[model samples]
Target: MEKGKVVVLEDRVPKLKERRRQKANRRLIAYLSFFFLFILCVLYFQSPLGAVGHVEVSGNRHLTAERIISLSGITKRTSFWKVNEQNVEEKLTRHPEIKEATVEKQLPNTIAIHVREWRRIAYVYDRQTFFPLLENGRLLKQEGTKTAPSDAPVLVGWKDGDAIAEMTGQLAELPAAVLGAMSEIHYKPTREYEDRVIVYMNDGYEVSATIRQFADKLSHYPAIVAALDRNVKGVIHLEVGSYFVPYSPPKKEDGDETTSP
Candidate 1:
């Protein structure tokens, strides 16, 4: 060392000790935090807080919420972790009315069940009871109601067979406007036309059609009716050859009764 030029030595021991102390403190803090979190997790899982606290249902129309819940086998005491989503969904879809089912588990003990039910396309009347017909061609006889479902056509003379099932399935494809206008459907099978049927419309017009291609032809009803005189309550033939014939009465000429063709 030269005179008036002094070299200062660094205090590395204290600096190293301070760094170790800080690292130890940080490690201790991390350990304590992990311990507390572990204890909280254990307590949370063992307590009722982990149990299902709330359950919600959606997308149900004909079936009640209570009915859906009962089918799901979920209650207030059910553990949130114990609910098997796939099992519950399968159970709900077992019913004929439910088209699809979805089950979801939400955080903090909430479960939700959403279901899509088959649409009620029409109603069939049998033995003084009116039963709803689903879009899947299933007749809900056990779920019959005393009142007629005016929203859909009432099938009067349909019998339980493949023909009626096929007919109802076809009716499901009809548009809302045309289906609403049809009040009743009569199934009349003849030797010439085995699938002959008649439809009574609410618009003061009767429709003569067959089960085959009935929905496709009926879709043109609005446009066809628009071109004709609505005031004349006649029969609209929606068969192979579309035509309209008014309801005319017979006349007596020279004491001989004559009818107009």
Candidate 2:
């Protein structure tokens, strides 16, 4: 009986040793896996994969994509994790033409810049140069050799403050066709109408309007001009109501008709 009990004990010892060996192997593997993962994370952060790989810009006009990107101060060397989206957006919006801006980052490295530029509605002429009037009623000084845009009418006879602001606001509300049809605008205030303005149109018609209801009345310009004789050119008064007076040619004596040479 004693010999059988000892034999059973000896068999259990080898089984216990095998179990311990298996547990140690599992621990070794876990340690090795943790070490390998730590090394991988370090390599990833140091590699180009962590850097900005692509940059895309959208919703930009009047300012080029390269200009916007340059203003953002973001480059390929910029770390994707370190990018401050708000800072980039603020930097971009600092430009005079940019109205709003947004910056976003994508994982595994991509950045996107979205910008909204102020719409240029007209030009204000000063000192023989044309400055752009934006939709928000701010004027932008002309740069380089850029001339007045043909799409917008030239604002003449306006000093700086409230008159220019009022005119630009009115111009912004007009339809694109009406705005484009205008060639020049002169502030011709009269005793009866202190806010009156004379608009010289590209179609060879002139408009007399008050700033109080300028856009509302001028919107009907096309229809009014359409009703007139094509050969007639004169002022169309829009302050009280719409009317046209044809320019009268100079009178000639009966004998003034020249004989054939």
Candidate 3:
């Protein structure tokens, strides 16, 4: 032994302990790596990480969820990460009955779809069955045997493209008071007067006007009715402007109030 050099009695013991520590670390790393690989396999094949399980639908009115989902062609096999949300929405919205559709992906395995359905503003009579006219003025194909719907008015006019849109615009602009008072809308589209429209009000008064000015003209109806006698039953011509033609009344003596035209 050299002078000033100290030797520890447990040299071999220290080396043995260091080798044990290294082995423990290697085992721990191996265990952690195995766990990581196992998790990756589970996620890749058996886990719900990419599977679709829940389908939530919202904002639908006319069309049911099942119908919309079927139309969209989205299935449980659809992978959430690989789904084309816009394509799904486009498929659902292609139908005239569907106004709008939105698709969203939830975590794990869930999907949500929100849809806005068209509103039926009127009905187009097809001899036996009447197809509903949506608020956008698009007419749907007749689906059933239900006769006149007592709820909304029946549209009688040239049944074709953009007709429903025109009618819907007019209906949307109608005053709540007049709309509540209206019974029917007679659509008489003609070359002589392209925008002609006639409506039968619940108060037994007739409204004849062009749709071009229908909204503005109909707004003055309550005042027009208020200024006239309740017994007056005739056509209120809002076609050119506000004018009332009374039904022929019995000629009265000079003392009676002079009736309006």
The number of the candidate with the highest TM-score is: 1
For model 2, how does the per-residue alpha-carbon lDDT over 125-240 read when each residue is reduced to its tens digit?
Answer: 88878888899987887441247668788888888479888888888899999998999999888899999999999989888899888889999988898898877688898989
| lDDT of candidate 1 over 109-216, digit per residue (tens) | 999999999988788898888898989888887899888778888888887488788887788888878888889999987787788888998988988888888888
Candidate 2 vs 3: which has more TM-score: 2
Report every candidate's CA lDDT.
0.87, 0.85, 0.77
Q: After superposition, how far is residue 168 of candidate 1 from its true place, in Å?
A: 2.4
Local lDDT at 66 for model 2: 87
List model 3 lDDT by residue over 25-56, tens digit each.
99999999999998997786555556678788
Q: Poorest 10 consecutive residues of model 1 by lDDT?
A: 249-258
Candidate 3 wrongly placed segments (more than 4 Å): 1-51, 76-82, 135-137, 142-145, 150-152, 157-182, 188-195, 202-205, 219-235, 243-261
- The best-first sequence of candidates by lDDT reads 1, 2, 3
The residue-level lDDT of candidate 3 at 170 comes to 76
Residue 232 of model 3: what lDDT? Answer: 67
Clashing pairs in 2: none
Better of 1 and 2 by TM-score: 1
- Candidate 1 positional error at 141, Å: 3.2
Angstrom error of the Cα, residue 33, model 2: value is 3.9
Top candidate on lDDT is: 1
lDDT for residue 37 in candidate 1, whole number 0-100: 100
